[model samples]
Target chain A: MNVRIDTYQQAVSRILRFDRVQRTAHWANALLFGILMLTALLLYFPGLSGIVGRRALVVNIHVWTGIALPVPLLISLLGPWGARMRRDLRRVNKWTRDEIAWLWALGRRAPRVVDKFNPGQKLNSLFVGGSIVVMLATGIVLKWFQFFPVSWRMGATFVHDVLAFAIFVVVIGHIIFALAHPESMRSMVKGWVTEGWAARHAPAWLREETGEMEEDQSVAHSD
Target chain B: MTTTAKGAPDQKAGVTIAVGRRVFLGMTALGLAGIVFGARLESVLDSGLQRLFPWWPGFRIYSISGSYPMISEAEYRLEISGLVDRPRVFTLADLKAMPSTSFSQEFQCVTGWTVPNVEWEGVKLSDILDEAGVRQGATALSFESYDGADSESLTLYQAQLPDVIVAYRMLGAPVTTEHGGPVRLYVGPMFGYKSLKWLSAIRVVDQVIPGYWEQNGYPLNGWRDGSTGPTDLALTGGVA
Candidate 1:
């Protein structure tokens, strides 16, 4: 009974980390990217293809899923409901000195205050956005191969193949990182995080969000 | 502002960036190995995996619409007309009754991927044109399919290539309906699209009339070697 009360108190102190638009877009990306990966695997591995022989259907699904990859995020960014996501986008695009320092201080655990989105997250989002555009363009050329020159087809195939492998690895890495930072994952999933968790990991953002600061000293932990 | 170099996520950030670097590098490495689809891949993949997984190189069945037109063997007729002394409507049995030419080669698609060693048997297109004697000025053969959407053409010279057959059998069996069967044109030297599936008509024309894919963006002469098809192949495979 005492533990339950403590848990309730902690929940009461939880911060709203992600808005509805942000959560929707994140989950949408997960679902679409999941489907794209599954279809892509079915298309790529010949052994796998034998088990499920309706390649035309699999290919159509993969292609349409790829074409639709950016829709949810694009929709989320366009509407009034996307206001918070837009603000977060600005934060993701901007780089703080500490974010840069955090990137450089790789091997050693150094002292730096964190923001809502770290530089690594920004890089990831950038790659995902850029790759979507590239993959779509190259994918079109692949489907309508007659229009372009053979060399363009070859180059597009090369780039598309390279980007696909890159996207797969990046997605895997993103999942691993998200799982590693369960508090962060919960923030994205439930749109909230425990105040203590945010305070520990993202002190500057916590202070900015809640307007709370320890006047005597920085709450930045020097690991 | 005071959020300066106050501190860092030395634990999560370091691990994240390190993993990020490896992922990027891994992609670069895999990319170096590279990927080439279609017949070009025959060198890299054909020997072992092709035997193990023959269906690895796939064929895309296409028509103007996303579907094919169904014409049973009994209902099918190939009309050979225009600028000819003897224009003939050949039933599947008629074409099969003629002395057949059978050969095995890759059915290469312009989009890449190849169906390899596809055994095709039918009378040579030239033999049919000889039977349906060409008029004085006829210079090209225009082909239309039963679907009425897909069409293709070859010049008089290309039409006479020894390897170009009006195929009735593929894969050692009667060509099935889904594969444009009963009787279809198969031009071995050119891309698979040149072989009109579910063939319905062959019109001998005075000049070239670009077919369906040609009306789109495909080169009218879709040589598998990526050159002027029969012109180059003429030295060996060409017949008068």
Candidate 2:
């Protein structure tokens, strides 16, 4: 009877929410972006720059960090180790009508159905991906301004500044959201979430994980 | 000073004023104090901090102009005039034919970027000044770029520094147009900006005339660490 009880408890225990590859990629991206932001600030502000000193070193850190920004993501998308990440990327890109409804119904009676990522998370991922590419291009132009035309350089400067400000705001928002959702934060770090937590927060994802039909919305609320 | 003298209400004595005499005097004194000491002290303190911690953070070049004027070697000419016996022009070839000195020194920007041990080769600025035979009362020299957008001035003493040169070659190659080359001024001891780019004309002046950057709040003595006499580019307004 005790062994049967233990087996039942194990069935309801922690289930893998993020694979090791996904966790690695996410953490690596976060760290690189954090360093890039810090170094960028030191380079941009005169007062801050004076405190930090060694501007060339700061520039190198910023440039090389930006260059390596996509490396983890790209690596995570390769090989059998990346299968889960690859599927999640597709799911994140494929927005269903319920996801849109969930976003619209936010702050009201919201839909209980959420996949591995909600609409907001998907949007954030898209934005972060697009920003990394744009920022890298503009940053390269800024670093090698002499190679480009003056007009192009000026435009790149303006875009880089505006996008950096936007990224700073979004990244802050991303951290805040992560902090607000304690289970989600733990899931990213630990590569798992308890079955009960997944059932509550990501019912459709839990069903998909359990080899159940993904199409049925009738029981979207697992609770 | 000329503008101040012209604009001074000092002579307008006792005309019915809104404020009381003491209040007026106080405000005037405060304003004058802010004018003279505030800017100068801020710059002095700022550069002082830099000297103490020469480790600057960031790489950027500051330029006042949007366009660069790149005159080719054929078109490039260095005109030496004003307070000179022989106010003559030296072609690029003429400059190249003259004795050239080569040395590697740190190219330090005022805005806090340094390209260290940059190899520069060119004619000594003093040699040309000597050739021109500066008039007895000449106290300073003015440099104008072919670009028409930039100008620089140095006291006669500063202009003749052993390392100050009219550089035609840099980094083992003919100076590129982007580096302000073909002919450019290289002032070794001071900030890189004092070394104006794009060789064009040099005019000896009676007093220090602030360059474009100077007029825009840069110290007249743009030494790396306030290493030279500021001597008040402020005082030279009337003389220039």
Candidate 3:
């Protein structure tokens, strides 16, 4: 029984921070978002419009990209990776007192023991996910505005623009945070961080997976 | 353990049904509220928005030639020739003397802006076609603008569409030169590009002739029904 438990702990410890499926979905969504932003800039800015060669062409690409934004997410949800994502999402949604204290003491000290994703990361993901749905619905209405009354179209356009600006700000903040933490960036790119980095930054998560904590509490406490 | 497993599906099915019913009820309530609110607010709020933020207009001048030809009412004449039993030229006074029809229509642009409820007063193109005696085998009517650079054509059937007219007055007044004056053709159901301004001549033809914008990738039909056409694909270099 002891040998079997030791082997199971080793297997979990060897697992990468992000699996192949998750990384692929993340990159696909990133590419789609880039396409959406570029097309939107081309449409909204008249001075840059000449570079696109034709207005109708860019409009079609923009509409089609907006429609395809959710495809990667939906595809990811069909596999075991989806179940893992749901578990992570549940963890993020329910904040413990320790998390609140961590937020209050941020920059002054290291945060409390966090799981795979901290509260900030969870909030960012949720905002982006919700923004995608809002953008898709508003885009469809605008594209097929003839089917709807003028009032509805007006309302939809207003909402879509406001949400797009908000999402842009959130995305910038997310990128800055990723860049600030080289270990987190490496986990997303290489699908793993050094065991030392995981133990130091995500002690609870490492303990949950490996069923053991590092002996040096000072290392975990330091930012 | 076996009995508990068997009961699980039944409980899951019951939960699914309950959730589905709640979703249905919630959606129905939301939809009803939306319809009621939309109808009540559309007239007042839509107009208010238009007033505050008017980007495009009902009568935006877009002449192919930099300058629009200005013709006096006295000098203006609409010449009808080609594939007609009787070729004729009618002065503005003669066109006004014919039985007139008026209606409000939304002028839609191919670029996706619309000017709503524009009241146009004019005689039907069919009435003028009738007067000129369009000969058998004539499939289309080509329109020339006094502006010299722009022209449009419609099939004989298109010309006969009930609302298509040679509009002389706009909003209960004489159409100014700035807005396709002494006379202009209004292809009511088609995009604004098809409605050639500065009306000069109409010629009956044996085949469909592509208009100015139509030659440059705007749709030939351009009907407001949102039907996909060659131009819609052509704009994307036929990729879509």
Candidate 4:
């Protein structure tokens, strides 16, 4: 009976792992980010632009994509996922002692309690979100550079390039981590992780999801 | 003891003289420092930013004609017609005979590149217009290239700006064929497009007419000073 109950609870947890809203926003944001990265790469590298041909077309597409990037994000805010996104945003802003300890330990030791997002993931999200805002602002100024003073335009370009470099480094780091942990990728793609995988990696999070302290305690002891 | 002009003692006058000399020296030092700082600041603002980017020779050449048109100096004639009471034609020598003025200006292209402190010497467009006797109703001037491949227009006001001239020389030398020799329109505060190259003819008109690039979707009023004028170009299709 105990084993059967455990199996039933695990199935429930798997189903509730990632809802449609979160999955949609994640994929949409990723798609936009990929487009932005490719266009930026082409624009920054003159050789690449030469190879691509049709520089005007590439530039137009890049400008349009950059302008349209925030659409999905803004749309997501009006849907059922809005509250969840807000909660995640609030959660990411604060770093708990356990999170700091987990970071210091370099994942060698687990935190006493973990939420839906790990500290690193939270930081990554915050950075990417902040970067998008900055990129959008600078991009608008650059596109309408004629409207602004030369010094202001130059300053905007400087800031935009610096931020792009910083974001590029952070994105590479994010990709490396994602590749290192295939389970994380699977969770983003398939919207579910196995009970065992969750217990091993995010045991505290799994406990919170299950809402059974005694059962989680037993599982912890067994491990 | 020697007496001063004010009948003061030589000792007191000597002290006053010393103080005056010191004050004069301080002011001279400050003035020299200020001039140096001002020059440095101007240089940085002028060409330092341009140096940060790849520098191209001969004004970052862009021509719709595919190739730069070569006009022999002997055959070149600038025709001034349309809303002029006295329509006239001037040869290269005739333009050269006119009084010439030179000024240092930054050239800004509509495509977002700039060349700074280009010394252009030419007869002012206003002087030419005045010689042709511009009619009262003339509102704008249409400039055509020698090859007739491209043309640009400027409002009468824009053409009359102090820096607006029909340039035949750049950097103290005659303008090269590659850089619109013989004569090219130079509207200093406007984009390079408005400063039409390979000039051939000018026609004063009653209304603003779009030029080559302007017709192909560039701002009609390409002001480099970032002023949102009444006739500011309305960008369409992300061209500019």
Using lDDT, give the best candidate's number: 1
Q: Which stretches of candidate 4 lie over 4 Å from their true place?
A: A1-16, A42-60, A81-83, A98-114, A144-150, A212-223, B1-152, B155-188, B191-207, B211-219, B232-240
TM-score of chain A of 3: 0.80
DockQ of each: 0.13, 0.01, 0.07, 0.01
Question: Which ranking of candidates, highest DockQ first?
Answer: 1, 3, 4, 2
Cα lDDT tens digits, model 2, A30-125, are 999999999878767655654554545677788899999989999998866886787676655655555555556772545445666666777677
CA displacement after TM-score superposition, residue A69 of candidate 1 (Å): 5.2
Q: Which segments of candidate 2 are over 4 A away from where they belong?
A: A1-8, A101-112, A212-223, B1-240
TM-score of chain A of 2: 0.86
- Residue-level lDDT of model 4, residues B1-240, one tens digit each, is 111221222122122222223333444343333322433443455454456545321254544554466888899989999999999999999999999989998776554445667899999999999999999888888889975678898888778778899999987788877568878889887777788888999999988778876765566787776553335643321122
DockQ of 4: 0.01
The best candidate by TM-score is: 1
Tens digits of per-residue lDDT, candidate 3, B1-240, equal: 222232233232211112222333454344334433533444445577677655322243565564557899999999999999999999999999999999998776654445679899999999999999999998888899998878898888888887899999987789877667989999887778788889999999988788877776566766665552644432222121
DockQ-best of 1 and 3: 1
After superposition, candidate 3 runs with Cα above 4 Å error: A1-15, A97-113, A212-223, B1-240
> TM-score of each candidate?
0.64, 0.49, 0.51, 0.56
lDDT of 2 by residue, B44-145 (tens): 454554566454322343333444566888988899999999999999999989899999986765533355568999999999999999999899988998
- Cα lDDT of candidate 3 equals 0.69
TM-score of 2: 0.49
**What is the TM-score of candidate 1?**
0.64
lDDT digits (tens) for residues B155-198 of candidate 1: 98888889999999999999876667878899988888789888
Ranking of candidates on lDDT, top first = 1, 2, 3, 4
Chain A TM-score for each of the predictions: 0.86, 0.86, 0.80, 0.80
Instruction: Evaluate residue A40 in candidate 4 and report its C-alpha lDDT on the 0 to 100 scale.
Output: 75
* Tens digits of per-residue lDDT for model 4, A106-139: 8778655555567677657766666676677667
